[model samples]
Target chain A: MTRIACRQLAPRIGDLPFNRELSAAAIRDAAGADVIVLPELVTSGYMFASPAEAAAVAVRPDHPLFAEWAAAAGDAVVIGGFCERGDDGLLYNSAAVVDRGGVRAVYRKTHLWDAEKSVFTPGDRPPPVVRTSAGPIGVLICYDLEFPEMTRLLALGGAHLIAAPVNWPLVERPPGERPPETVIAMAAARVNRTFIACCDRAGTERGQEWTLGTAIISPDGQVLAEAGEGAQATADVDLLLARSKALNSRNDVLADRRPDLYSPLLHRRAPS
Target chain B: MTRIACRQLAPRIGDLPFNRELSAAAIRDAAGADVIVLPELVTSGYMFASPAEAAAVAVRPDHPLFAEWAAAAGDAVVIGGFCERGDDGLLYNSAAVVDRGGVRAVYRKTHLWDAEKSVFTPGDRPPPVVRTSAGPIGVLICYDLEFPEMTRLLALGGAHLIAAPVNWPLVERPPGERPPETVIAMAAARVNRTFIACCDRAGTERGQEWTLGTAIISPDGQVLAEAGEGAQATADVDLLLARSKALNSRNDVLADRRPDLYSPLLHRRAPS
Candidate 1:
């Protein structure tokens, strides 16, 4: 069985060593798995006290912890998020897909959320779907999943699965309701017809807790597997089923799109 | 007979008199109706050349079109989108629920799409359900429907029917597939367990042409009724049946939710 895992991580803000140790340990625990994903910016948590703090925690790819993770998870392909210094000397919210062969690929999020916009410039363009030992993998940080167009593009590029690393905040629209995380996971899964494995960080980051909805949403929009509330959880996924759904006809939101018209909308100036 | 007229209209963006006149004419064509609904942002076009151009068309309770539309519709209650100058002096993408007594309630969109952020701010808050001639009517703009919380709030607040006006862009993701608008509509209707009257503007606008697949989605996530391909459409709603469905305990997403966990997630901050 080609098993994929989405592991919920618990990281303290600004505690890079603790987060890195946790991630390395988790990768070790997920040994022999075909693939694994972790939450976005987990190396430095969701937010930093200032740019200096962020820069200090954001180590270079050559940093020892990353190499340790790659060596530890050498048996399985791993994808995780970290803060990287771009060539332009700016910081980027990047996802690094790796194997024992060093970094397999890197994807910088094209769409930046509110505070993110101030910290990082949007990426130049979306990365192409990369072939993996398990399947074709496409990686997006948080916020990118909400834009159907971005995911649709990845689907068109023949990605069998989409891996997202999110730090979903706690929300309560009703005294009780479906968390936005579940909805987004469900929507992404249904539209792309691909396995969506997202690692959501858990625990309270100074009273602002995350909904640790570590979930593996199926192509049919079912939560095939999910972890428990709070800190850590893991899910198992059958990679083949994800590809089958990607190739399926009826519900393929990407395959069904009339791109001729939308490509224009993708540009800054969409038609009225 | 409790007749409701759900017409798909393409009122000129920001042309108040033209929009009112177009609706009045439709109302005349379907006289003795209990309700009338127009397209999303019907008061203004989807893309505004500038914020001022968009705001130039907004209206409030004292606007002349409000009285004119209510009177012209005679006994029918009208729901449609218009620009409203909010308390903060900014404009909102608002929908006015008008009846003989005047404007019953107004709902601004909770979730603003890409370009909309440049012009309109998100509605101050989720609105309370308003009692309508047919039953309790809840109002939300287009993107708001995408956020499940918007619908859940109204459903929890006792809304049996939801009226949404939308300006959907035309796009071809697949060679021969239905537009995203159709799929989203069905998804919203099914998830909310309320009859969805979605009036969408068809045809090309300013620079972007749109796919005109307007329809009324049923509580079961099916397109109960659909319109033709262009700037006009309509569908009849059976309020009694929808109410009965909501009342029943079977097959409703609303009843199946695990509210305890969801409430915290709904109001949570966006993922970092």
Candidate 2:
């Protein structure tokens, strides 16, 4: 079993020092968790006005802020998004996987959402499935969860648990229902038979409203724990519960895939 | 706008003539729909005890039963599943796209569900994108809907509406909530920006319970129409609602895909 904690904090844009302090406090408070996930761009915030504005707040993996995060992580693994300043001096919307030892892996956001394309370069490489004391954890940032291919690839790569750091903008929906992002996440967990921890930023950023809080879904698409708007959420889950992808004795979800029929999905040109 | 109807009827196993009559009557009741979808294996029913028993109930495309279905279709296009006796003389759990003119296209079930592999031959080719007066309709049967690749392929192949014929057995879930199948369909529709019409069967067949209803989901993931257990469902939807896959000004869902990084998904080797 793995104890997962989520810090759904609202960060002010360009307020690096304040955001770092907030993150450190949250990590320290979430003690005894095997893994703690924080929202996307928690350090720099979302809704960057311009490329220069975004680049201004970006930091390298070796930044002093990560040391605090690592120390706060204690014996746990922490996965959270940040504004990354790459070696090539380019800006990226990235997530760092940090443990007691140090930062283990970094994943740049692959499928940039609206307006993000103008500022950040899309990550060319697939996100890594980092092996941890708890289990294998795969990371995805915000809109990357909308693409099934992203989760599918991670599951194929042996990810038992997917950690998502999202800055979810609230879309219009009828009263008393989950957001589309939550719905999509639930479906992803069910289809892949993998546990998913989605940490979303709360409160409005600039004028855009965020779908605040977090959703921890089990392999069977059950909501283990979910926080309401502007609330923190956490869940203790059995990681080995997702080891079996079988829906029934005769039907194994992953083994039933017909790769031959899925060839059209790989082609650059759309199938006619 | 296109008016769509679904006939959620329960067919007794191996009862070909009675099933054909029931389908025709329902099509007549639907009256003025642009398209009507029916449940999987509507003719032969699901849960076959043996191959010979299933083959006994299967019919060829040119069989007289299709003539009645085509006539009952009126001016509307009908998408319904049947036990198909293929040209190779093998039985296939198949769906036929029929209209007033005749049968337009036939799609064999690609991913066989539990126990089905023993009786039916899986289809080799991808499901067709048949052009209709309302829009292009892509076909998938039952378990195929569980695979995100199937829906993504149809969307990439230029389908605006996906017609699903399903024989959904009720899975374990909390009482008084939507089934996981419905959740997956809603997510598929939203991610693909494609309207989905799922026609599911009702009642029990050989002690196995059925989901027994229908769900009509809009491109935005809203349930335009839904039916309770054993009830008929219908909705009038604008086909052009799916013309734009763009969620916002800058992000077109299909175009936003990074195909370059998805190559690992095409490999036949299951990653450890």
Candidate 3:
């Protein structure tokens, strides 16, 4: 694979036409890539201006807006976040892993963070590691990356690449350093020894400022290609190489796990 | 108080005399600051270069080095890692929180990483959060910072500052980013919302590459002051401010943990 584009899509909040148009343009530019990743809730910037608006903009998996970029997604795995309405009418933060073959697998946000728990329900089941045309891919929504065990679960189950879409807030600190969110992603990459295509949203939305630490990190947690403070960045990864590294096992953390000690906490039973 | 001197000491792999000299020199430079911290393994690098060399370096609580430093330690509270031979002859990776008053508490690292298990035993009990003139302090060794729950335990127990002494190796990835050891330390600062001062060793001894990412991290996880890629560095902390941030709970991660949902995992039976 030659390139993957991490689109730091910062569409205007609540502006459907503008967001659709802007996302289309980004898709055109990323057409040259093997994979293109976008930030969480990029289809709708952070989802809602208010609870009332959330219900209005929420769409199901078959939303017409996604149809616009389907053709451009040919030969590429285009991954992005959106608000999906479940059969029960509850809204879920979900990622669509689509190829020209159509939407591949949908991963709902598992382990919601902070204010999200108030709005979105926790996912009932774990995401399956789907075999895509490119490789066996795993997708995680923003907060899903925080739990070490979650990523470990995906990796041990045979996931080679983890695609993440996030909306990081503006934190005034180091220029290139990401607010804890990016660090967690990098940690996941190293521990799993898998490629992480993490795209973060950029620009200020009305009043709330968002930080974009769009980057493609290597299996060793190296940020190979990083977007600027707020820019769309692109990268390329070799899946075969990553698999070889994992199989051969060099100085890899995932290879050296003391599973006997970890099994207790991982398999621990909750009190009744 | 200003001008805290953080000593990034690489104690003798298994030599006690060499370890004492390194600690004594760093103590001499501990001038105006109200606190001082040194890297773990100040008395003897817990990892044995050879199993045969282990017994020769491990010290006891009554060792003269402890008394000498206790009596002469500057007006500041000085803390660093050492090796203590328990009655069972098992070596413990211990840190002494020493002040001019006396040796306050000796913390044995409760969590050990990787190869550490073969050389040293885990602490028998939990680390104590001791009250000091500078602030409420807690001590942890190199690998202890990796466990988020352990650090949270320290914070919940009313620790305002965590002093960790580490020996981290330089890594090739993340480009200019600090080694993974510092990343974990910084994450501890962010998650716990406390000031974390990490003293790490410097220099490439023989062929081994030691990464020096010594620094003071603020409650918000910002590096207040950092020692470039070498031995020693120092940073003055506004202890009261860090304590207030942690106490009042400015960052919501610490404040709003969904212990109810997570509590299940607490009582969960260990993995088989």
Q: Which model scores highest in TM-score?
A: 2
lDDT of 3: 0.69
TM-score of each: 0.55, 0.97, 0.80
Runs in model 1 deviating more than 4 A are A229-232, A244-252, A266-271, B1-272
Task: Write model 3 residue lDDT over B1-272, tens digit each, in one string.
Answer: 44456777666576688778778667766666667788787777655665456667888777778766766576778888877788888888888988877778988887666556667777866667788888788787776666554555666666778888877666664456767766666666765577888888765554666777788887777777777543456776676655543322222444444343343333322211
Q: Report the lDDT tens digits of candidate 1 across residue range A1-272.
A: 66777678777778888888988888888876778888888788876666776777776677777787788886788888888877677788888888877787878876666566566666765654778887788887776665444554555566777888887776553333345556655665665577778778877776777777777777766666677643334456676665543332322343323233223222321101
Residue B259, candidate 3: alpha-carbon lDDT:
45
Measured on C-alpha atoms, candidate 1 has an lDDT of 0.67
Docking class of 3: incorrect
**Fraction of reference contacts reproduced per prediction?**
0.00, 0.57, 0.02
CAPRI-style grade of the A/B interface in model 2: medium
Cα deviation in Å at residue A166, candidate 2? Answer: 0.1
Clashes of 1: 32
Which is the better candidate, 1 or 3, if ranked by lDDT? 3
lDDT of 2 by residue, B1-272 (tens): 79989878888899988898988888888888889999999988898999999999999999988888889988999999999999999999999999977889999998898889899999988888899877899999989999988998898888889999999997778765568898899899999899999999987889999776488999988778876665678898888878788898988778888877876554543547
- Model 1 chain B is weakest, by summed lDDT over 10 consecutive residues, at B263-272
Expressed as tens digits, the lDDT of each residue in A118-197 for candidate 2 is 99999988988999988999999989999888888888888889999999887888676578888899889998999999
Candidate order by TM-score, decreasing, is 2, 3, 1
